[model samples]
Target: MPWQHKIAYLIGKPVGISLSNGQGTSGILCDVSNGKLLVLEYLYQSQFALKQYDFHMIQDINGFPPCMSQRLY
Candidate 1:
């Protein structure tokens, strides 16, 4: 299976997404299928919305409480 399919296991979990356009967004990973990503973004108190993104536009993906692979110091 492709790496994207592996992300399906993280469904319902919050994640940070980096886009090819140099933009970034974080949200709950709702679903991933057919080269599409469904994210649930929090707009405000008691308000939320779902956004769809093309899988191809994604540059990187990281989960919350990010961990560094290398020492910064």
Candidate 2:
């Protein structure tokens, strides 16, 4: 599929991914590109502290969008 169509169709789904800094969290796939994925509502730990996160994208899931539904309900 086209990149635009892939991005547009990737807005709502769950993806199993990790951060570049070695953190773990799961959320809806909000956006995508050839090099990253915009994941919403992410979670991770840093500097010995727990943190809430948003807008995280890594290099693993690069071309393929999340293979799940975005809706939580």
lDDT of 2 by residue, 1-73 (tens): 3233444555676555555577656666766544455666544553232233333433233234445867788
Q: What lDDT tens digits, residue by residue, belong to model 1 across residues 1-73?
A: 4447557676888998889999999999998877888999999989999999998898877778866789878
TM-score per prediction, in order, is 0.76, 0.36
Candidate 1 lDDT trough over 10 residues, lowest sum: 1-10
Off by over 4 Å in 1: 1-6, 66-73
Model 2: lowest-lDDT 10 consecutive positions:
46-55
RMSD of 1: 5.3
